[model samples]
Target chain A: MAVKAGGFKRRSGASSDIPSSSMADIAFLLLIFFMVTTVFRREKKREIDWVSAEATRKIDEKRKNILHLWIDNVGQVWINDQAIADEDIARVVRPIYAQNREIVIAVRGDRDVPYSKINTITKQLQAAGAVRVTFATRLEQRLQRPRR
Target chain B: MPILSRKQRVSDEIPTASMADIAFLLLVFFLTTTVFNEEKGLPIVLPEEKEEQEVSAKNILFLIVQPDGSVTVRRGESEQEQIVAYRQVEGILRQELAANENLIAAIKTDPSAAYRHMINVLDEVKKAGAERISLQMVGE
Candidate 1:
């Protein structure tokens, strides 16, 4: 008996063998997304004005307690409402400062106040045991137009 | 012949290779979404040093110089008044030193305040046993 050898045998498995490539692409995309989404926290320091060319590192805001001081254009040293003598600054600050060890004193001076007064006040705060100090200034307004 | 055909059929099967590509794509996607931080600014003037010196932590304090040239202690919303008198400050600071041996005082002055006024305040703080002194400018 001659076997039929000319007939074709149909393949039993499915025609498509390759898996979907979309899953890999999705994974890679997710990885890139995570990397781009991550944010680094920068150390926060109290803002102060420095006249020197060198810059200091930033400090954390949570650790700092700020003391606000205002200097008038006339060079008068007023602490809140009461006028204080030049010599009495440390004395007044010492007791108040002792209560809180972590304090950042912030100084806001008028543009016209003499530098000498500013120096004097800084010296006194140092004597009173203030560890941190910050300066406050308004950003220079951009010149709009030349005066007509 | 039959065994050879079976082997041929097995060899013709395709392998799945998309997982690696998916992983790489996910990694790239996450990397593109990250954000960075910006630095904040504070207007401060550091004191100049004639010689290289280390400031002791025990002698530093803080002073605030307002636009009006007035001085005060930074105590939260409620500020305390501390004027620029040498004798008065010296005495009070001395008491503070007695209580705490390690005290470093820092002074924050306003740029607008008279330079003379700042110097005077520094003189007083120094007189009170504050060895380590630093100056900072006020930022609005």
Candidate 2:
């Protein structure tokens, strides 16, 4: 019986440690899954000169709640990658406001654009019943502030 | 010769003990380095359409921006206008706001004025911590 017990000890030589061979495969699978599921934003970047401000703040609203309205230096307005006429702004934005009541219009106007163009856009936004607005600007450092 | 034959019989599997550590290191590096492009701006709420409220003229502070980028400050119910550089607007508005808590900063920009000129004045007014702000266009 003692000889059989000694022989059984040889049969019980299975590894007590957890197998690590598949760990790399699991991590690689997660990495590939994240890479596949990630959606990249592909908005075309407009090259308008950004206005800088000392009072610039980060808009804390969610990405979905904010809408980008770009006004180029020539006073041309662009929304959602489409060039929109000044007269048609309210019409275009009304439906979007209807779809999402919490939509905040982010006016990314060029610094050289006339104030009248911005005024007109604000009026159109008011007509569309979307009141919350943000003027997107770069943060200006106080050291480089131009003295009048 | 027997040892050389035994060496040839060894297992041919590649070792992967540290693969998880290497992958996790890469993941941590990417996670720390990835920067999201966040939205930034000066936030303001516009009044609803046709929702004009009658504010007393004494409670209004006019900041008239010209096409030349100069600012003309005018108090409500006063004919006197003070022309100052855009940089001094914050100091002027801060003093006025201290005396009158219900003061409204009415920024009237010329139609032909560059947008930055208006924004400069607006930034100063906002810096002064004015709660009631009205944006208007000249000759509108």
Residue-wise C-alpha lDDT for candidate 2, range B1-140, written one tens digit per residue: 36555545677777678889887776666556555777888899999999989899999999999999999999989999999999999999999999999999999999999999999998999899999999999997
Interface RMSD of 1: 10.1
Every candidate's lDDT? 0.54, 0.90
Candidate 2 wrongly placed segments (more than 4 Å): A1-39, A144-148, B1-15, B21-33
lDDT winner among the candidates? 2
Worst 10 residues of 1 chain A by lDDT: A48-57
What is the DockQ (computed on Cα atoms) for candidate 2?
0.49
- Candidate 2 has an lDDT of 0.90
Cα RMSDs, all models: 18.7, 6.0
Question: In model 1, what lDDT does residue A18 have?
Answer: 67
Chain B vs. true chain B: TM-score per candidate: 0.46, 0.86
Q: Write the per-residue lDDT of candidate 1 for residues A1-148, one digit (tens) a residue.
A: 7645644565557857565656666666667667665654433332333221111224345432555565665555655455678778788778767987766665655644566676678778767766356544332222573422
